[model samples]
Target: MTRVVFLLVPQVHLLDLAGPAQVFSTAADLGLDYRTEYVADREDVPTAQGLPLRAGTEWPDLESGDLVLVPGWRSPKTAGGPRLTDAQVAQVQAHHARGGTVGSVCSGAFALGQAGLLDGRRCTTHHSLQDELARRFPAATVERDRLFTTDGRVVTSAGIASGIDLALHLVAVRHGPAAAAQIAREMVVYARRGGDAAQDSAMLRHRSHLSDAVHRVQDLIDVRFAEPLRLADLASAAGVSERTLTRRFTESTGLTPLRYQSVLRLERAEHLIAQGSPVESAARAVGFGDARMLRRLRSARFQS
Candidate 1:
């Protein structure tokens, strides 16, 4: 079993710890070989959420394939948050030196920086701290807008909920996209966000609209984006005329039905290609009749 050790700093944000913990725990429930433990320099640490969490004071004996994650704590702007000891910092550095992967969520990047892991590496933290991180670690490359960044064996995430995304990404890397998708579906997450800094999945990006008609149409397209879909059928399911559905969907999501489906297809094709599928195979797998159109679309999208 792969061991995932979480270093719980004082005044840690609950969601920063809970989100990724839940992902791994759920993966284990699905029969993945994962074991989780919580460790801290002190036996009991107070959280920013007004609860005290108990943890082991001793670090576990970790080996290759083990992961150590530092969850974010209360902002340094506020007083009385936890600080890592010299011993704990050394432990993190030693783990990375021994080929173990190290990760951080939000301000946990500060701890990793203190461990000297951030030097000469590309990483990220919560957007609010990006400037401070860059200033503190002059040699580190801090990406300000990314949800996360992984350089070598180190991974760091932007903020609280992004931890779940980071963890799911690790699951995909370790297992496969299918496994990550299964875990995401079981978690009721609509779709996994890609690592791209500027864009999120269409379902998430367009979900803020309050139109029932548009939402119904989106639900249909999201599930069967790889299949041929008729606008009239989508309109009927949404209890609207085709023209009305078109107008409302465009108003809400800024994309027509066909365009929305194309985006999903392109996203899937990119994933397949990243997994080593040939362009032709990925194109066919995502419902393109041939690679020519896929190539054209990809070039057009990238250029624009």
Candidate 2:
């Protein structure tokens, strides 16, 4: 069995703890080898929602897993009494040093950051802490809009409900698509989102940039997913080479320019389709020049 530890902190968000636990439990019921336990620096930590959760194991023996999950606290922006200390930090770092994967939910990225496990890695946290997380961990790529991010041994996620999505994705990664789908069906959530989907929804945004040129290009793309967007036009307006634009675009947003634009188009098209627009019209509205191509794309995306 794969041992998964939930590292609880004071004033933890109940949903953050429950979301991933449910996913793992569902996976086990569907025949994946998994076991879950709670661990913490203290034995009784009061939660933000007015209850106390026990710290199941001592800190020394907490390293029991192929995985360690740090669920977010309710108000991570504020310093609270049950906050993880430097000692707990060291324990997690040591576990990852031995090749165990560390997973985090919402503001749980802060714990991982404290542990130095997130240094020089791609990660994310709840949108509320994007600036603070980036400021605290200069070496890490802090993504605000991504559903979740996994870089090597560390995985981080966006706010609240996204924890379940990240857990289901790990199920897909560790077990297989069939297993993940089964778990998602049981949970009544969508199956795991593709990496590109995660990037498009949460990681890429109009406001998260340092360069005016990149911002201009991204803003234009955000508004005009229905228009024909050309690399040359974007690069010309931004006053950079296509290669430089591509590199900067990916560096800032973690997505290639073309793929980023495609996501915007697809998402817009999906909204229209869901609203009962004719598929052909929706495709054209989203810059797909051919109705036949839209049909093919729609067919690939959804069976119905």
Candidate 3:
């Protein structure tokens, strides 16, 4: 079983703690060997949102396959005292030294820094804390405006809801994209929200709009993106004329239907290629006739 340990702190954000917990818990429900455990400095822990929690003072046995995540807590802007004791910080250090993965959410990055884990790692936290994190940990690379970042096994998120994204990413890395995708769908989260630094994929990027017709069309396209889709069929699915569909899709997503499809195809093809698929093979897998189109799309993407 893969053990996921939450190193809970006083005043931990409920969502930051719960989001990742839910992901792994649901994964366990889906038959994955995930055993989630919570540990704290004390038996009773108070949250920033006034929710009280209970945890064990003693930590569990860990292996290299396990993960230790420190969820963020509330802190003052001014120089406040250290949140974690030196002993707790040493535990985090030892965990990484033993080759186990470690991570943080929001102000939790501060604890990792106190442990010296953030040194030379690419990490992130809540946007408001970016400057302070960088100011304190001059050795760490604080990624600004990022949803999440992974420098080797030391993953981090911007906190709160972004914690869910980081958890999904970890699931995807160890398990597979299919596992993460399944979990995201079950949780109603948009999967593959672009790169680590961006919001998400084209589907997620365009999903913020609340147009029912556009969403229906997008749903159909998401399912059959690897097929030869015609405008008429998309319009039929959206219950609109081809012209109207084109306008709505563009206005909602900032891309025409065909452009959106091309973006999706390119995104999928890139993943396949990253997994060592040949360019031609990846192109064909995403419904392209050949590598020529894929290459052009890639070139245009890079050039612009």
Predicted structure with the largest lDDT when compared to the true one: 1
Better of 2 and 3 by lDDT: 3
Clashing pairs in 2: 145-202, 145-203, 146-202, 146-203
lDDT agreement of model 3 with the native? 0.87
- lDDT minimum window of 10 residues, candidate 3: 191-200
Candidate 1: segments with Cα more than 4 A from true spot: 1-4, 11-36, 46-52, 60-67, 73-87, 90-101, 114-116, 126-138, 144-148, 158-199
lDDT of 3 by residue, 1-304 (tens): 9999999888888999999999999999998999999998889999999989999899898888999999999863546624787778888888898999999988899988888888998988888888989998999999887899888779888988888988988899889999988998989885445335453457787899989999999998998899999999999988999999999999999999899899999988887787679999999999999999999999999899
User: For model 3, which pairs clash?
Assistant: 193-200, 193-201, 194-200, 194-201
Candidate 1 lDDT, 1-304, residue by residue in tens: 8899999888899999999998999999999999999999889989989999999989989997999999999885456335689889988988999999999999999899888899999999887788888988899999877888899899999978899889999999999989998898889886577555432455677789999888888899889988899988999999999999999999998988899899888878887887689999999999999999899989998999
Per-candidate TM equals: 0.71, 0.66, 0.67
Q: For model 2, how does the per-residue alpha-carbon lDDT over 24-69 read when each residue is reduced to its tens digit?
A: 9988887788888889877897787997888765744434347899
Instruction: Please report the candidate that would top TM-score against the real structure.
Output: 1
Model 3, TM vs. native: 0.67
All models, RMSD in angstroms: 4.8, 11.3, 5.5
